[model samples]
Target: MKLKIINSDKILYEEDVFYLKAPGLNGYFQILENHTSFISILKKGNLKFKNKKKIKKNLNIEKGILKVNKNFIIILL
Candidate 1:
């Protein structure tokens, strides 16, 4: 899956990720390729993902909005 992280200034990161772990409003959830489209609010926490070969990495973030569609994902923090 492709992920993009943006803040008030500019885009922070953009890359292909195997999967992503995010803190949802109610709980935490994982996003993978072909996952259903949805939107949610996030809390202060780490946003984790994997590279093409499945190497995991993480981005620490504060409150933000998350959106996912069939083609791509956009994360605004």
Candidate 2:
């Protein structure tokens, strides 16, 4: 799936990921290929994802918003 992470300064990350895990307001949640669409508020925590190479990556983020739809995800911080 296509994933993009952006902040007020610049775009942090943009790539294709096999899986994504983010810090939801209540807890943590994950997204995978063709996942159902939804939007959620995020909390201060780590955002994780697995690249096409199956390598796991992590990004520390503050409060943000997450939107997912049609195999695409956008993270605004």
Candidate 3:
């Protein structure tokens, strides 16, 4: 799936990820390939993703919003 993370100033990350884990307001949730579409408010916590190469990455984020549509995911911080 395609993933993009952006803030007011710049794009923090943009790539194709195999899996994603994000901090939602209620709890943490994971998104895998071909996941259903939805939107959620994020809390202050860590955002993680695994790339197609199977390498994992992490980002410390403040409050943000996440949107999933089709096979693309976008995070606004």
Query: For residue 52, what is the lDDT in candidate 3?
Result: 90
| Each model's backbone clash number | 0, 0, 0
Candidate 3's C-alpha runs over 4 A off are none
Compared with the true structure, what per-residue lDDT tens digits does model 2 show for residues 1-77? 99999999999999999999999989999998999999999999999999988889999988999999999999999
* TM-scores vs. true structure, each candidate: 0.93, 0.96, 0.96
Tell me the tens digit of each residue's lDDT in model 3 across 1-77: 99999999999999999989999989999999889999999999999899999999999988999999999999999
Give one digit per residue, the lDDT tens place, for model 1 in 20-72: 99988888899989999999999988898888886889888889999999947
Deviation of model 2 at 9, angstroms = 1.4
Q: State how far residue 75 of model 1 sits from its true place (Å).
A: 0.3
- The models' CA-based lDDT, in order, is 0.89, 0.96, 0.95
For residue 24, give model 3's deviation from the true position in Å.
0.4
Task: Show the colliding residue pairs in model 3.
Answer: none
